[model samples]
Target: MTTYLPPEVQAGLDDARKRALKKSQRLSVQAGEETFRVLEAWDDGFALELAVADHLRGMVDLYDGPTLLSQCLIVASEEDGDQMRFEYKRMTEATGEQPVDFEKPENAPVALIGKG
Candidate 1:
């Protein structure tokens, strides 16, 4: 069965969609064995993205791989208008290994892996 959203809810979704499209930016990350790409980031603190398939399995293959799953987070700075920063992190996992840490530190090298 298909149920429709309430009018108010639909309106809210529409507004969010407009805002997201206006300020959307792409982001990518390499965590453990898999890479992640963030499709969009808006002025608001919401990120629309997806994780690479087989990421967890690839990590398991690595001896020193991160046990936690990797994700892409959006960081926005008004000072750098229209430019959103991509932050990477690993969430807690069932395994015992520590999660991979993600941060934006000065002097971190920025490179383009390839064309999306």
Candidate 2:
């Protein structure tokens, strides 16, 4: 089954996804024992939302392939016009005061390819 999405945001999301898929930008986020996907990323932290039956606070690790990117606290948030997502609590040595723009073609994480 397919869900219908209106224009504007959907169009932009589709375009960004297409570009990201081509570059193989796969960001792996690890929290506790479960790992989630990064929908949006910044210098300090990344954003992710999963079917979490409950919310808890803990350290989250973001990785690009085998390399560790950021390790920080994650909290749950459900705001208006936003998905029930989790965000990094603070910035670490990986990310400085200035936020680095991700989701861009040049700065997006690279996806890993495997053989069948």
User: Largest TM-score belongs to which candidate?
Assistant: 2
Q: Supply the global lDDT for candidate 2.
A: 0.61
Each prediction's Cα lDDT score?
A: 0.40, 0.61
What is the C-alpha lDDT profile of model 1 across 14-114, one tens digit per residue?
Answer: 77864575445333335454544434433332222322222222122111133333333333322222233333232322455555688667987788587
Candidate 1 lDDT at 111 equals: 86
Regions of model 2 farther than 4 Å from truth: 1-25, 43-45, 52-56, 79-82, 94-116
Q: Residue 46 error for model 1, in Å?
A: 25
Candidate 2, 72: how far from true, in Å?
0.6
Please give the distance, in angstroms, between residue 71's alpha carbon in candidate 2 and its true position after superposition. Answer: 0.9
- At residue 112, give the lDDT of candidate 1: 58
lDDT of 2 by residue, 23-82 (tens): 555777777788665656655444444344135457777777777777778776543233
Best by lDDT: 2
